[model samples]
Target chain A: MTQTSLTLCCKVLCVESDDDKPLASPADSLALIAQERANLERDLTPDPRWMFWPWGFAWLLGFGLFFLRFGPDGRVFVDLPEWLPLTVLSLSFIAAGLITGIAGGRSAMQTRGPSSRQGLMYGLTWSIAFTGMGILFAQYGDALPDDRLGLLWAGGMVALTGALHMAGGAIWNDRQLFILGAWTSVINVAGILVGPGWHSLIVALGGGLGMILAGLLGWLRLR
Target chain B: MSDGTELDPVIHAQARLRVVSALSVLREEDKVTFPRLQESLRMTAGNLSVHLRKLEDAGYVEVTKTHQGRTPATFVRLTRRGRLAFEEYQEALRALLNPTSPSTSSEETL
Candidate 1:
C-alpha cells in the first residue's frame, strides 16, 4: 500500500489490528507510546510568554506611575497642594484600571483564559509587595513602626484590593483585571494613611502612567 | 517528519496536538480520564479513542482500568518515555523557530 493510503486506512479503521483482544496489552503498548510521545515532544513549543505579559505590565505600570508621580523627584502635578497627592494617586489607580481593561482586551484575545488560581496568587503577591514598600517608605519617612493605626489601615486596604483582584481574576479569567482590582483597592486605603502630600505623588504617577504605558504597548502589539 | 526521532505527520494533526497539549498541562500526580481528555479536546469518544489507541500502541501512554463505583474508568498517563519524547519534540520545534539558539544544530534547526 502507498504510505498515504496506509495512513488513511489506519485513520479510517481504528479497530485494533490484532483481532484476538479488543483491549491492548498495557505492558507491551506503554513503551512504544512513550517513544512516540518523545518524538512528538521534540516538536512542541514552550509556553508563550506573551500570554502573561499583560498582567506583568499592569503591575509594573501601577508601581512605576506611583513612584514617578509622588516620589521626592516627581514633577507631574507640582502645582497641587500637599493634601492633593493622595487623591491624585487614588484617581490615577482608578483611571489606570479602567484604561488597562479596555486596551488589554485587545491583546488578551490571543491568549487562553487566565487560570484563576494563578491570577489570585499573582494578586496576593502584588499586594504583599505593595504593602512592604509602603511600610518601608514609612520607616524612611522617619515614622515609628509601632504606629498600629496606620499599619492596620494600610493592611485592610491591601487585603480588600487583593480580594477584589482575586474575584475579578476568577470572574473574567483576566489576570490584568485581577491586578487592577488590587491596585484600586489598595490605593483607596492608602489615600487615608499616606495622605495627599508628596508621598502620594509617586503612587499616582506609578499607577496612572504605568497603565498608560501598558495600554500603549498593547496597542502597538495589536497593530 | 518521522526520522526515528520526529513524530510522523500522521500523529501531528491538530486534534492530536490538542490532546497532547492538554495532557502536557496535567499535573504529574494526576492522570487524565478518557472523558476529561475527550471534552478538553472537543472530540467524540470514538475519535479520541482511536487517537488514544494509536498513542497507546506507540508505548507513550499507560492506560489504567479502575472501578469508580459500578462503572469502569480509563485513565491515561504519559510514560517516562512519552514525557521525554514530548520534551524533545518541543525542543525540536523551538529549534525550528529559533535557529540562532545554541541548542539548535546547524542543519536541522531551521
Candidate 2:
C-alpha cells in the first residue's frame, strides 16, 4: 500500500482509539489527562487585579452618586454648578475605564489569549446603554413627580447594572458575580419600594458593599 | 490498515505526548511560557528543557526565548506539522488497537 493510503487506514482505526484511550498504557494516559485538566484549571482562574476594577468602580461611582443626591444633612450638597457634578461623574468613569483597561491588557498579555475582548465589549455596551438611558430620562422625566423620577432613574440604573453582571457571570461561569448581580437587583428593587428618599443610601450601601465583598473573596481566593 | 508502524516516534513518547496534548488545547496563535508548561506538567525545569529541546530539534515544536521585564521567559508552541503528526500518530495507534477488525483485513488485502 502507498504511504498516504496506509496513513488514512491508520486514521480510521484511530477514531475508536481516540475515544477509548490516548495510549496503550491506561495509567500513563490517565496521568496525561490529569495534567491537561490542571492546565485548563489554571488558565480559567482569574487574577486578583481583575476583581479590583469593579470594586474600585463600585466604590467611586456609588460615593459620587450618593454625594450628588444628598450631603450629610439629607439635602443637596452643591447647587452652585450642574456642570461640575457631571464633569466629576465623567472623570470617575474615565478613571474606572483606565483601571480596567490597563489591568485587563496586562493580564491578557500574560495569558496570551482573546478573553479580555469580552470584558471590554461588555463595558462599552453598558456605557452606551447608560448614555441612552440618561437621554431618555431627560426627555420624559418631567412627566413624573421629581422625587418619583429620581427613584425610577436610580432604580433602573442599578437594575441594569445587576443584569449586566448576571449576564457576565452566566457567560463566564462565575457564581460569585452571578450572586452579586442578583443581590444588587434585589437591593435596588427593595430600595425603590422603600421610598424615593432612600434610593441613594440603598445604592450606596448595596452596590458598594456587594463589590467590596466580591473583591475581598476574589483576593482571598488568589491567596 | 494495521499500520501501527506509521506512528511518529517523536510524539509517541509519554512526556512528548503530554506536552503536545497541553499545547493542542490552546489556539493556534497562542504560545505557552516555559514556567507555565512546567507547572502544568509537574516536571522539573531541566527535564522539560530537555524534552522541549528534542521536540524543537525535530521541528515538532517551536521555542522562543524573550525577556519579561528583567527576567528571561521561554515560550513553546506546536507547529502545524507537529499537530498533523500527532493526529496521524493517534490514527496509527487506533489501527494498532483494532488489528483484528474487518477494516484492517481489507487494508491488509489491498
Candidate 3:
C-alpha cells in the first residue's frame, strides 16, 4: 500500500531473461522502459543537421554581402553594383530553400500520415507567409521615406523569418529552433534601431552566424 | 512472483520486449522497415527474424515483405490487439511491482 511495501513487491517480481539473468527492481524496469523509448526516439526522428546549415550559410553570406554594399549614411564599403548584393542574397536563399526542400522531401519519402502531411503543410506555410509579406511590403513600399525603405525591406524579412522559425519550433518542440528565431528577431530589431547598413552587419553577424553555430551543434550531435 | 497477474509471455523476453517497445513508439498505423528495426534494437537479422516470427504468430505484430523501388524489404508494425496487449502487459508489470499501486485503486475502491 505504501512506497516501501511496493518496493518489496518489485523485489519479488524480478523478471528473468531467457538465460536466467535476474532483472532489476520494478522501478529499474520502468527506467529501462523509458531508456528504450528514448533510444527509439533518437533513432526514429528526422535529423535536423541538413536543414539548419543551409539556412545558416544563406544568412551569413547573403547579409554579409548586403552589409558590404549598403553601409550606413550612403557610405558603401564595397562599391559593388546596387543589383549585385540583392541578387546574391536572393540566389543564396533560393539555394538554401532548394536544399531544405529536397532534404525534407527525402526524409519524408517513406513516412505517411500526419507527420508527412505536417511537413508539407509547414513548408507551404513558409512560402505562403513570405509571399504574403512580400506582397504587403510592395503595396506599402512607396509610403515610407526613401531612406527608411531599405530598413523596412531588410529588417522586415529578418523579423518574419524569426517569427516563422519560432512558430516551427513551437509546433515541433524544438528548443534550438525557437531560440534561434528569438535571436534573429532581437538582432533584426537591433539592426533597424541603428538605421541602414548597420542593420545588415548586425543581422549578418548575429542571426546568420547564430544559425551556423546551432547547425554546427546539430551536426556534432548527429556525429 | 506476481500479484495474481502475469506479464504476457510473448513480451516478457528481453529481446522481444526491446523490439516491441521500440515499435510501440510509432503510431499504430506507422511501420518500421526490418533493417531500421534491427538497427535500433541492435539485433542480428536471424535473431530478430526468429523473435518477429514468434510475435507474428502470436498476432502481436504483422510482418510484410514488400518492395521499395526495386529492392526487396520487410516492414513490421504492431497490430491493434498487440498494442492493447502491450498496455495490459505494462499494467501487469505495475501490478507486480506493487499490488496496491494507484492504478488498481479505482477498481479496488469499495
The parts of candidate 3 lying over 4 Å away from their true place are A1-35, A79-84, A131-150, A216-223, B1-6, B44-49, B57-59, B62-75, B79-81, B84-110
Give the Å shift of residue B103 in candidate 1: 3.7
**What DockQ does every candidate get?**
0.04, 0.20, 0.27
Instruction: Enumerate the chain B TM-scores of all models.
Output: 0.81, 0.81, 0.87
Task: Record all residue pairs in model 2 with backbone atoms less than 3 Å apart, i.e. clashing.
Answer: none
Clashing pairs in 3: none
- State the C-alpha RMSD over the true interface residues for candidate 2, after superposing those residues: 5.5
lDDT of 1 by residue, B65-99 (tens): 77656888777766666666566555444443354
For candidate 3, lDDT tens digit of each residue in B1-110?
35222346687677777778888887767777788778878889999999999999999999988887899878888889889877866765676567676766643452
Candidate 1 accuracy as TM-score: 0.36
**All candidates: TM-score of chain A:** 0.32, 0.63, 0.79
Between candidates 1 and 2, the one scoring higher on lDDT is: 2
Give the worst 10-residue stretch by lDDT in candidate 1 chain A: A39-48
Give per-residue CA lDDT, model 3, range A82-138, as digits (tens).
888788889989998898888877666544446667778988998998899889889
Better of 1 and 3 by TM-score: 3
**Residue A25 displacement in candidate 1 (angstroms):** 33
Q: Which ten residues in a row are the worst by lDDT in model 1 chain B?
A: B1-10
Real contacts recovered, all predictions: 0.00, 0.27, 0.27
Q: Which regions in candidate 1 have their CA more than 4 angstroms from the true location?
A: A1-185, A191-223, B1-15, B65-74, B93-102, B106-110
